[model samples]
Target: MHEWALAEGVIKTIKEYSKDKKIEKVVVKIGELQQIDIDIFKFALDELKKENSMNKLSIILEIEPAVLKCRVCGKTWSFSENLKELDDFIAESIHFVPEVFHAFIKCPNCGSPDIDILKGRGVWIEKIKFKGE
Candidate 1:
């Protein structure tokens, strides 16, 4: 059901962008921190696309790695490196609200709580391929 809500939001954005234009394809980037099930998300997209009259629209999904930067030490690290340290509940917290990462994670280099998300936080439309070029 959560995936359905996300899919609905995506469809709404596509609808706005495709106003009076034919969309050949949409490339979506999914962030790892979101913890989205790709297959479920795709299924939701397909169902929503048909409901929104976008049956012809092609959707391409790309998964991006989560990267975090330490604001204090200027060191960058991959989120996956620390994933094993987190329990299921903590991971779920980050999945629902990425901003809460600061509450549970600290900089690996300097042990500072001040960190910046470099990439892979949420899903977004990366590129839209339109018909007829």
Candidate 2:
């Protein structure tokens, strides 16, 4: 799964930032639009940690919900609030290309296609706790 690659990148980044220090905890914020499978991501991270002899490291994942602003009505709402409006085909399309949601999904407030995603577009490391030396 691609989660393995993502996990690897995270591990690499942590290693670089830690610079030989042991990691006690890692907090990751995953955007809702990214559609990351938590189970697979955790599995990949666990495997990577084991490989790197960091099995004791704690990984925490936080979900950042997608927020969209309607350009027409100037209203903002969570994407999940309008999930029922998305058809299977459109949902699948958005799952692959999150940017497409603005074009295909209309604003719930004014039914306008002009919408701007305010948040939840990318993955990031929120915080890292290093082990005491």
Best TM-score goes to which candidate? Answer: 1
Candidate 2 clashing pairs? none
RMSD values for the candidates in order, in angstroms, are 1.0, 2.3
Model 1 Cα lDDT, one tens digit per residue, 41-82: 999999998888889889999999999999888999999987
Candidate 2 lDDT tens digits, 1-133: 7678888999888888988777899999888876778899999999998998888889899999989898888999988876667788887777666787777777777899988879886568999998773
After TM-score superposition, the amount by which residue 33's alpha carbon in candidate 1 deviates from its true location, in angstroms, is 1.3
TM-score of each: 0.95, 0.81
Which residue runs of candidate 1 sit more than 4 Å off their true CA positions? none
Model 2: worst 10 consecutive residues (lDDT sum): 94-103
What TM-score does structure 1 among the candidates reach? 0.95
